[model samples]
Each structure stands twice: as structure tokens, then as C-alpha cells.
Target: MIAVRRSETTLFTSREATHDNDTVALTHRAGLVRQFGSGLYGFTPTGERVRRRLIDAVDAELRAIGGQRISLPQLNYSGIWERSGRWESFEGEMFTFENRDGKRLCLAPSHEEGVVHLVDGAVRSYEDLPALYYQVGRKHRDDHARNGLLRLKEFTMKDAYSLHADADSLDETYERVRAAYVRLFEALDLAFVVAAAENSVMGGSASEEFVAPVETGTLDLRHCTAEDCRFGVTDESPGWASVGGICPDCGGNLVAGEGIEIGHAFKLGTRYADAMDLTVDGPDGDEWRVHMGSYGIGIERLLHTILAQQSDDAGCRWPDGIAPFGASIVPLAYEGAIRETADRLYRELGAGETLLFDDPGQTIGERFAESDLLGIPRKVVLGNQFRETGAVELECRDGTTRYVDPDEVAAVVSGTRSGD
Candidate 1:
């Protein structure tokens, strides 16, 4: 589909990369986990915690929009692929094959077909004109492959499609989705650009990519260094935006940067509506083609992106709301009764305070070394002397150490640490 949005005035505009103060991913054992990709990552309880927190934020944003996550099957058949003609165009980008029955199937590359198949069965009127359907599930791609989890063959993604009655209706949904995306990224604490983008394959006019730039992210975007620009961030994806003396949405000055497109929203208009003959009868009994748009965000990619942007050198530093387990309990002892103290402390830590007990069989050096690798924010050293003093030597991954009493452990975890 032809891009309908008017092009910006600038030529050869350079995209700026993200300026995060910190970006790190915590991996347990790499180049050693046989059969896994080089960057193939399996989240530690801590890493998983970080991923879930980001996911919860996304889902909460979706739920606020009355959207929900649904699962789509991994194997989708030839009928839809042939129907969309994606069977031919998808090429190496798509993972496709056939079973004994000779049905062309894919790893359900995208749910556009699946969703369309669903819509094809139910809605018959413009009263059903505006339907927004979304899913958070695994998607398959014949990826170019990469380091870490940036680009993977199989990963989670969120695809939302909106069906509307007219251009104005589609535009409204587009704007709402766009706003939600902005809020969503901001909530994740990453800088992103909403650049005017080309709908490479999804087939649409006027698309915007919500790119979040990280030092080593797979997606690249150009944006402004000055974060105050009201035009939001210009996407260097297809790179279009006119910068006059003033901002389009505000009077603020304009600036730029590079962005990693974590999300994209497209105004399909009647492209799919016409392709699939999705005409609906209006409440006034008028028949009209449903105007449509599709929004997509790679969920697992987002998880990796969050881990990329949010962590420190130690490990995945997940935000409090999303850490898989809140605390990592490391029992660093070189003396008597250390084991018993750790056991006692573990039993009495408090309600819902998840901890990983590192009862040392290794040297002090090994225990400390592992602590850096297993980066739970707050590390509680269950030492022998703790029971006497009524506290443990608390080590923070953010670089602070102290004697935290049982009473103050909650305080520290509750973020009361002056050192945190």
C-alpha cells in the first residue's frame, strides 16, 4: 500500500541513538548453554522478574483500553496463507511448511489472517464497525539472527487490529493507540520515538513506529536529543517529519535522536477491508467497507529491550513492581552456625518476601563473585553474627553494603535504605 501521509521537509536527517544512563542484560551462562543460540537467554528468577514487570505494565495499559491478551496457535494452515498470498511473498522471512495432508502451515507468522478468519465468521454490520482485537503470544520469524535475545526465531508479540467504519473512525483509533503506546513506553522508563514509518509488509498507509533506542538493540531510530519537543520523537524508520521554527504539536523547539521501534501502529484504512470483502451494513442500513488499522509490538523483544535499558553491570536490575522475586538471600559464612542462621532467617523473612538462599560450599571469593552475577537488588547475607546483632550484612547490587536488622530488612526492601 502507498504511504498516504505527507512527507516531512527535511532531507538526509540522521537518527540519534538512545541515551540511557544504563543498559545491561544479565545472563547465567552463555556460549556454555549447549543447544541454545549465542544470545539465547533463559531468564533467571531475577531476570524473569524483570520481564514480567514490563509485561504487566503493558497488559495494564491494554486493559485500560479494554484490550486483552489472547493466544494464537503456532501452526496455521495454507488456506489463509494462500488467501493472503503471503505464502509466496513471505519467503525466508516466514517459517512455513506442510504436513501429510499437504496443507501449507506457518508458525502463524501473524494473526492478521487468524483474526480476519475470526472476524469473517461473526460481524456483519457497521454497528460492529469498530472492533479492536489483540493478542500476546509467540510469533515465528526466519530471523536474520543476532546476539542475546534482540532478534530471535521465536518470541512473544502483541498484535492489535482495529476495524472501523470510516477514515475518521480509523484515525481516531490510530491516535488512541498511539497515545497508549507513548504512555506504555514512558511507563517502562525507556526513551522512544514515534516516527512516521513505512508499512513494509503489513500493507497499509500512514504508519508510526514506537522505537526505543538501546546501545545494541536490533531496531534503529532517529530522534531528538531534546526530550521536550512536543512532536514527540521522529522515527527514522522511513524518516519523515518537517521541522520548522516551531513544533507541530507544541511551540517547543525541535531536536533529534535514534530510536528502536518497539511498537508500530498502521492505518490500514480499507486495504484489508477491501481485500477480504469485509463490508458491513450500517445502523442506517448502509453497506460500507470497514476501515482498519493494525498495531504490533514484539513482547519478548520488549522484555529484552527493558532488560537492555534498565540493568547495570551486575545483572538484570528489574524494577520493584516486576522483579520475579524481590530479594536474593546469599549466605556468606566462614564460621560456625552460619548455616543455621541462614536457615532461621530464611524461615522468618516475612510474608511474600521471596529470596534465593546461596548457602556457601564455595570460597568467600566464589560467593561474592556469584552475587554479582545473580543480581537481585537486595542481597541478605545470612552470617553467623546476625542473630546476635539481630541483623544481616545487606549488600545492594547498586553498590552499598550495611548491617540491616530484621526489622530494617523490610525497611531496606521497602526502599528505606539511604544507601539504595
Candidate 2:
């Protein structure tokens, strides 16, 4: 069992409030991340644990959809962007500089041009079409990063691109990817909506965004009033006001709200392939421009959105699969039988799956408060109850408490206790 002492990491649970948003406040208070500069932050140990789990979950979903994982370089030659006719358009937002060798290099904000160039000569036949490649890496931008993790100059992103021989093939892969995204968000239990969005710099035939509505969000969204209808549109779309405040699919009234965008999918068509001269020979020996689609999930933005939507005034309350630790073992006093029981329970529950609060310097109240702030799902207490009656108390994040025998604590916390 991975036992973590309260004194190991500097927690800001008792620190003074420094931010206006409670979500951002709790993020710092719980020791999730630390800022180094404007728009730049580093993840703490607990933060890295949660971040790694998020990446693993995203990777699993993409791999299940036949996406081959590959790494793309973050630094790219400016010539590719020039060939794609986007260098001037993206100059204001992209990070470009001249290397010592007198060559212009850029920290890519997106990989449309780079990916096409990477596979330029590799895809020479129609059979090689419909290739789906993806990567989870760092992306750079020059925006005024603020609002905690909502906006950052540099962030992690999971981006996938698909090359197809025809529009029909592209459409099929796009829908599959859309479904995969739905599954992922639902698994996280996020109240998100898919909305038709503007292509903007990506310049695609069509695109959609996964947005989670929150009071602190900045993206304006118009969603259907009907509970069963999921149609919505973002104000970024041109002529959005012409919709007459109605859902085109169900004629339901539309309501406006602010939201944070977590993911986006674009049907790029032949924009990048045509610009970069990536083509595949058809079965009839004719050269045809490859169709392309790209999908992106903002890793840090999604994490921040989760905190914004799920956290409360007390602290964060992570979802089932996303919590950094499954359970925390809080012994009222780390001595004698109490410590022995806590250690035994930690062993039974799997050390890696549980965190033993073994620090003896703090009072019991402090330990309990820290556990709650960390959003641990279950808190097993070995206090007077255990000493008097041999009954252990299991405290859930929702404020529910129950007593169970020592042997049953694991099953009860895991929801595998047979009797109920």
C-alpha cells in the first residue's frame, strides 16, 4: 500500500484565499499545481497522478477506435506553415523564432501541417488511405493565459488525425470518433453538450465543440430547451442570430449560457492535404487529394472544467474513476492498536490503492479536513469507535457514515460486500 504522510507534501488547505474562483482556489489549496509564470504551471505529485490517469483513459478510448498512437515533434520548420498558407494567418497566436542556424522554427499550436508533411510520401496508394494517427503531447499558444487551467500558453492535448480516400470514408471515421468522445465524457460524468462551432483558424468544412456550461465560462452557447434534444450552437458560428432562438432539429426554444470548450472535432476535408501536396493514387491510376479530419481534447482545460463543475465550497469531490486515491485511511491516533489496525487495513486494501495518513504531528481534525479537501472517496477512521466496539467507521464524500467490521471494510468501500 502506498502510504502518504500529511507532512510529505506542502498542502494549502489552511492557506488564505488567493483566487476569485473557488475551483481555482481549491486546486491550489489541495496542492494540485504550482504556477511558475504567467500562463505556465507545473503539476505536483497528486496533480500528476490525476493527470496521468486522465491521459491513460483518453488513450484507451482512442486505441479502441483503431487509432495508432505516434509522437509528433513540437518544433517544426516554418516552411510547412508557409506551404499551407497559414503562416501569416497564425503569426499572431503561434510561437515562432529563428534558430542559431538562421532557420525559422515554430512551436506548433496544432499539427495539421506537420502531420501531413510527416506522412507525405508514405501514403502513395488508395489502400493506405483511412489511416488514423494520434498523439498526446504539448501544444503552444500565445493567448493571454488566465483563469487557472482554463487558458494556458502551453498545455497538453490529445490530437488525432485521419486520412481518407473519399468524403464517405472521412464521414464514417468522424462519426466513430464523435461516439468515442461521447463515451469518454459520459464516463467522467460531465454535464457537457455538443454544439456546432466555427472553424476559425482550422478552416474546415464543419466542426463541433464539447462544452461544459459553468458560471465562470467565457464561451457563449445556445442550447435546446427540450430535455430530449441535444442540438445546440455556439455564438462563434457565423449567422448564429439567424436561428431565431430555436433548435432547428426539434423547434424547441433556445437558451443562452456560458461554457468552457473541452474538445473539438473538425472535418478538414482536403484543406491540409491539398496545401501540402499529399495525394494517393486511386485504383484507376489517377491522383486524388486525400480527405482529412482532426479531433482534439484539451487535457488541462478538461481537468479544470471538472473542478469548476464538480467541486464545492468545502473542497474538491472527484468522480469515481478520476480521484487520485481510491480511499484514505485516517487513524485518530497513530499509536498502539489504532496504528496496527490502520496498517493492517491498508495492507488488505492494497497499499497502492489506499493512502495512510500516518503523520503524528497534526490533530485528528486536521487530518480529517485534509482528507475531505483532497476529495478522497472513502475515509476509514480508527478512532474511539474501533477501540471501544471494534467497529470501524467508513465516511464517504457525500457525508454518509457507517460502521463495519475490520474484515468487511475493503468490500464495503469497493462496493463488493456481498450482503449489501
Candidate 3:
């Protein structure tokens, strides 16, 4: 069985960042429901489950790549944009203001400028080349936003930038990160395609977007049916025949689809270094503009897509991988013998992972529906009248119901494979 979270902790807190396991994360996600506000979230239990899972997956992947989230101020450095020639173009869309010192400042739409400036302040030579710095933090945009969390004015982003000495080193890290992004999305159980793309708005020569195919997507993808090819994304209007060579996995024909762009990686090719005067002395003692690459993933968008992909009429059936609570246990009867037995079983099962024990006051139907809407994967029904002796009712959201012994839950949990 996929390991699950045991409890929730404060966001960006030292403990939350350090606890990388499954159970604690689910509890963490369960806690997110409390903070979701009027502008961005509707707060469905299943949605929270999906959101937590996606974040956990990406956070884990970034750690594997030697990255971590770091906090910086929400506003700073108006001159930095002017130095980069972005000050005018970014005018309205940037959340700008004058600081107490009368210096200009703005909220960051992207972290490239901030990261570059920070590194420039820290490094002075070849030894600092290939320094990788990343942060998963809140970002803001001043544009109109109404697409749920998919397009929010303020959201969380995981952005990493690598500074390199040689083009070869940059390329190696580039591909390494591409692979990392693939695995990150895969861990979240998202179907995605890394497409060759243009830095149309960003004005870069090299770039690609990791897109997830969703009905509400804004980007397009083309893939071929040829037996030997497996390409899916291109910036130009190439027909499927040209872009897709074959389905590398099964040799099946490939097709084109609209995709929601979620993550991206780009080669800066000294663009930002030049704009910001971020250069380091080379081995020959010559000043060299550091080769740079920027990679980003919208953590909130992943949450949105996860919700769109797995939820249904009854509610969400979040996979065990991401569910905040492994199961929502409801003791059907409250008084006398049943309550006592159920309370005992709940304590026993609670020992496994995070558990939201629904007390035995609501009717059976209410309990079941609430559990369904809450989208917890498994439901343990502790009713004294269970026809079977020495066993409680175990129900999976994926239409699995069984009268099972409480002690055997791990075995049954192991058998499920629906999601997250």
C-alpha cells in the first residue's frame, strides 16, 4: 500500500518541509481546507486531497534534484526591472509601489530576476558556477483571473534556476531537469507531454513546456502514430504525421490534443546575466556571463488538474498516494455497546494513519454520503450489527465493500490501486 500522512502541520514551517513521508502530508492537506479562501477555492475534501498529493510529489522530486524552497520578500527592486528593460512592459501587470524609503518595488511574476540578483550578490567566480537555487513560494500577477485555481492572481510556484560555466554543463543539467519534471508529474499520476515550445513572450531561444492534456487546456499538442516516434509538443503548426513518429510505449498511433501548460524549462543563454550584470571570472581569469536555465511548475495547477481528473458524482476518490486521511471511519451506532466497540476499533485503526472518526450520531445513509462527498478512499463501518462476527465493514470509494477484520486492514489497503 502507498504510505499515507499521519498528521497536518503548519505550511512552510520547518517541520512541514522536513517531514517528507506520505501520512504527515495527508494530514497537512487536510489542514489546507481551513485556509482556502473566497477568491480561489471551493474547498472540497477530495480537492484538498488531490492538491496535497501534487504538492508532495513535486516537493519530493525537487529535493531529489538538490533543490529546496526558500522564502523571500513579496516585493522588491523596481530598478531591477528597468535594468532588464521589463519595467515599462511590466508596468500595469506588476504589483508595484514605492517603498518607505521612496524606492520603487513590485511583486514578482517570475523569480528569474530575483534569483539572478541574489546569486550575483553571493558569487564572484568560477567556483560559484552551476549553483542551483530554487524556491517554491507564492507569486502574484495583476491580470484578470477567474479560472478557479488554474488561473489565479496569487498562487504558489516551484521555480529553480541553474548557473553554469560551460554550455556542456548547462545542457547536461537541462536534460537532467527535463527528466526530473517528467518523473515529478508521473509521481502525481498526471498524464503529460513535454513539448518543444517557443519563448514567445519570454523572448528566449530555447524552451519547452510540460503540458497536461485537459479539456480546459489552452495550448495544443501534436503526436504521430508511427511505430518509432513519440514526440508530442511543438511550437509550430506541425501536423501529427510530422511531430509524432510513433507511440514509443505501445506502438499505437498518436493523436493531437489541447493541453494545459503546467510546467516549463528554458535556457536563458546569458540573457538575464547580461541584464543584471551577473558574471563570474572564468578559469582563465576572464569575466564570463554565466549560462543560465530556468524551470518552473505551477503547484496549484497540478492541484486543479488532479481534481478534474479523479472526482465523480459521489465525490472524489483520491488515490492512497495523496489522500490526507487514509480512511474516514464512521461508527454507525452511538449509544451503549456499539459506541464502545466502535470507539475501541477507531483507536486501533487510528494507530495506522490519520483518521477522521465520524462519531456514531448520524444515520448510516448520511454517514455514507458525507464520506463519499469528503472523498476519503476507504470507509470503515463499525456497527455492532455487522452480520459477520469479529469483522467490521470496509468500503472503498471505487465500489469495494467488504466485511473485514480490523486487524487485516493493511492487507486490504495493499490490494487497492485506484489513485494518487
Q: Please give the distance, in angstroms, between residue 104's alpha carbon in candidate 1 and its true position after superposition.
A: 1.7
TM-scores of the candidates in the order shown: 0.79, 0.95, 0.80
lDDT of 3 at 273: 77
**What are the Cα lDDT values of the candidates?**
0.62, 0.85, 0.65
Cα RMSDs, all models: 10.5, 2.2, 7.4
Q: What is the model-wide C-alpha lDDT for candidate 3?
A: 0.65
The residue-by-residue lDDT of candidate 3 on 298-354, one tens digit each, is 877766566556566664445446765667666665556555655565555554443
Which is the better candidate, 1 or 2, if ranked by lDDT? 2
- By lDDT rank, best first, the candidates go 2, 3, 1
lDDT score of residue 233 within candidate 2 = 71
Error of 2 at 263 (Å): 0.5
Best by TM-score: 2
Per-residue lDDT over 1-420 for candidate 2, one digit per residue giving the tens place of the 0 to 100 score: 254655565554546657887777878988888988888989987887778878988999999999999899999999999999898899889999999999999999999987898889988998998889999999999988878888999999999999999999999999999999989988886878788888889987999998887878868877787875767676776657787777888998978888889899999999987788889999999999999999999888888888888887667777666777788899998999998888899888764477788888878898888888888878899989999999999988777788999999887778732112
lDDT of 1 by residue, 168-250 (tens): 98888788888888888776666665667777677778887777766765544344544654244443444354454455565
Residue 377 displacement (Å), model 2:
1.0
Shift of residue 19 alpha carbon in model 2, Å: 1.1
Best by lDDT: 2
Worst 10 residues of 1 by lDDT: 1-10
TM-score of predicted structure 3: 0.80
